[model samples]
Target: MKQKVAVLGAGSWGTALAKTLVENGHDVMIWGNHEKQIDEINEHHTNTHYLPDVKLPEALKGTLDLAACIADADAVLFVVPTKATREVAAKFAAVCQNKPVVIHASKGLEKDTHKRISVVLAEEIPADKRQDIVVLSGPSHAEEVAVRDVTTITAASENLASAEYVQSLFSNEYFRIYTNQDVIGVETGAALKNIIALGAGALHGLGFGDNAKAAIMTRGLAEISRLGVAMGADPLTFIGLSGVGDLIVTCTSVHSRNWRAGDLLGKGHKLDGILENMGMIVEGVSTTRAAYELAQEMGIEMPITQAIYDVLYNDVDVDDAIRAIMLRDYKSEQEFTFN
Candidate 1:
């Protein structure tokens, strides 16, 4: 069935997803706060700043009015940044009268609350205006996904039907969607991988070879699984798409903002300077702090996340922080192995 979908946020991911939805024969109305970007999408069918060199689907429309976008929409896809999710959801709830399936593609924890994106949406959107929230995450990058690369992602929700619904909506020859019921595992893996990407990028910037990068990726997955399992997620979920799949892609790909940010930091650039230069939201920079604090509260040992946290926020030298990690007490790497 042809559905009217509202894609909130005009960033690269949002534009790319909106275009994909259009290609799937859905009427996609993308809503953004910036009138200029909305006009660009409508008039030029291009979002040059975010998805440069990619032509948007001409049938896709853009809107500045939130109400118009939400009116009679069958589904609302929240593609805004992590920081703006709560605020945007609250606004979405205020204007939306219908109970559409709520799905978020963002991958990060809320700064102060340290809550996952699903939790934030559940709290912000009233039950009357929303359905069970769904999370869409995996190894897909907007730049690659925009061009229809063979990208695979997972649609996870507490309800299997909801997840399957999303899987059916997004699956195409180039873009495949797998359904998983482990929301906690999927969200945790998706959010925490950015921190490791920072570490991976740092390793790259510090003149480390593939051996060092491999070490970070391996140990990083361990820490991510440790913290994820501690937070009530299934340990095996880390091996799936949102877990190892996302970690490998984000930590190694040039399309990763988190890796790029970490690369700049590893090259001795300040956080503020890197953010300014990147002109994009580097989720790992903020995720490091959240994961660091959450680990402390949960009594989970995440040394890698802590090391990146200190480098990003504590003003510690990257080399010194790395040395501190390397010098930590060593034990069996298979301590958490499935026996």
Candidate 2:
């Protein structure tokens, strides 16, 4: 079935997914606040600022009118940055009349509210105008997926049917999506892994060897899994694509904005300078603060996340933060003991 899909935000991920939807034979109208980018997508079929060198599917339309883009669509996908999620959702709520399946491809919690993407969407988009909310996340990067690289992601919803419907929307050979019921686990893992990826990049910036990176990756996963579990996420989800899977890719890949930002920070570039130069949203920067706050609230011990947060916010020296992490009180590596 060819459905009209409204993809909000014309960033790399949004444009890439819109291309995928068009290739899958859906009518896709992308919405963005940037007029120049929207014009480029419609007239040039390329988002040069984001997905340079990739030609978007010609049929993919771009619009600045949020109401027009989403009106009468079968589904809406939010791909904006975390800070912009609420504002977009509020505008979308005011203009959209159809009760389409709500899906968000962005990851991160609202800064002070400490709410997940789904929660932000739910708060703004009324129940009557929105159907079951779904989250699409995993290790897939927009640059890879833009070129039709084989990528797999998970579509999660509390409603199984909603997840399956989303799975049907973009399940071509090049882009595969699986459905999971653990929305919390999937979203939590997707949001938190960026923080660890920052740490990974910092380690690399510090000229740490593979052993150091390996330790950070392993211990990072432990801390991520711990916080996820504390927040009602399934620990096993962290091991899956959204958890460990997403972590490995973000921590290592040049395609990851978070990793790149951290790499810059690690190389002695200041946070403000790094972000100003990157020209993209490095989610982990904001996520580190949000996750740190959440961990404190939940009484969860997430030293890796804290260390990164302190480095970014508290002006703690990366070397001192690392030494502190290494010298922390020792305990059994395993979370549980056999009786």
Candidate 3:
């Protein structure tokens, strides 16, 4: 079914998704704050700043007017950064009238509240203005997806129908979508994996070998699964696309902002300097702090997250943090046996 989809970000992911929707025969409009970028997208059909060298579909449009972009849209997809989510959602709620199946592709927990993006959306958007929230997440990178590379992701929602609805909108020859009912697991895995990606990049920058990288990734999954299960997520979801799949790609890919940020940090660069140089939002940097706080508050043992948090927040050296992690009391490799 053809639908008018409003994409609430002009970043690489937003433009890529908007392009996909347009190609899929849906009416898509991307809302961006920058007039220059919006004009570029509308007039030139390109978003060079984010997805350089990639040409967007001419059918896809961009608008500076948020209200105009979302007006009469069948669905609203929020792809903005975590910090900007609430502000954008509130604005959408104020202007939106009809109920749209709200979808978010952004991954990260709220800084202080430690809430998932879906939870943040639910809080800011009034029930009368929106339907069930769906989270689209996996190993898909904007650069790859923009080029029509084969990619698969999970569209997760507690409302199964909504998840399937989202899956229909995004599934195509190059982009495939799977529906999952475990919104909590999907969202948490999506957010927490960025933290591990940071550690992975740090390991790389610190001159560690493949063995160290493998250890961080494997142990990182354990930490993610532990906290995720404690927070009421399904244990099996950890092995699915949003968990291991997302973790592997984010940790290993050069396209990951979190990994790049962590690489700089591992090289002994200051957080502020690294962020300023990156010219993009590194979700892991903020996620490390949130996860650290959440783990401490919940009494969950997430040592890797704590180590990354210390390096980012407490001015602890990356080497010292790594050493501390390695020197921690050893225990059974498997915390619990699977039947």
**In candidate 3, what are the lDDT values of residues 1-339, reduced to their tens digit?**
999999999999999999999989999999999999999998998999999999888889899999999999899999999999999999999999799999999999998999999999999999999999999999989999999999999999998999999999988999999999998999999999999999999998888989998999999999999999999999999999999999999999899989888888888888899999888899998999999999999989998999999888888999999999989887888773120
Model 1 agreement with the true structure over 1-339: per-residue lDDT tens digits: 788889999999999899889999898999999989999999999999999899988899999999999998888999999999999999998999899999999999999899999999999998999888999999989998899999999999999999998888888899999999999999999999999999999989999999989989989999988888888898989999999999999999899999998898899999899999898898888888999999999888888899999998889999998899889887787864221
Model 3: which residue pairs collide?
A: none
Q: After superposition, how far is residue 249 of candidate 3 from its true place, in Å?
A: 0.3
After superposition on all C-alphas, the RMSD of every candidate to the true structure, in Å, is: 1.3, 1.6, 1.4
Residues 1-339, candidate 2, lDDT per residue (tens digit)? 999999998999998999999999999999998888999999999999999999988899999998899989999999999999999999999988879999999989889988999999999999999999999999989999999899999999999999999999999999889899999999998998899899999888889988987898888888877877777887778878898889888989899988888888888999999999899999999999999999899888888999999999999989999999989888787762110
Regions of model 2 farther than 4 Å from truth: 336-339
Scored by CA lDDT, what does every candidate get?
0.91, 0.91, 0.92
Instruction: Select the stronger candidate by lDDT from 2 and 3.
Output: 3
- Model 2 lowest lDDT segment of ten: 330-339
Order the candidates by lDDT, highest first.
3, 1, 2
Judged by lDDT, which candidate is best?
Answer: 3
Error of 1 at 291 (Å): 0.7
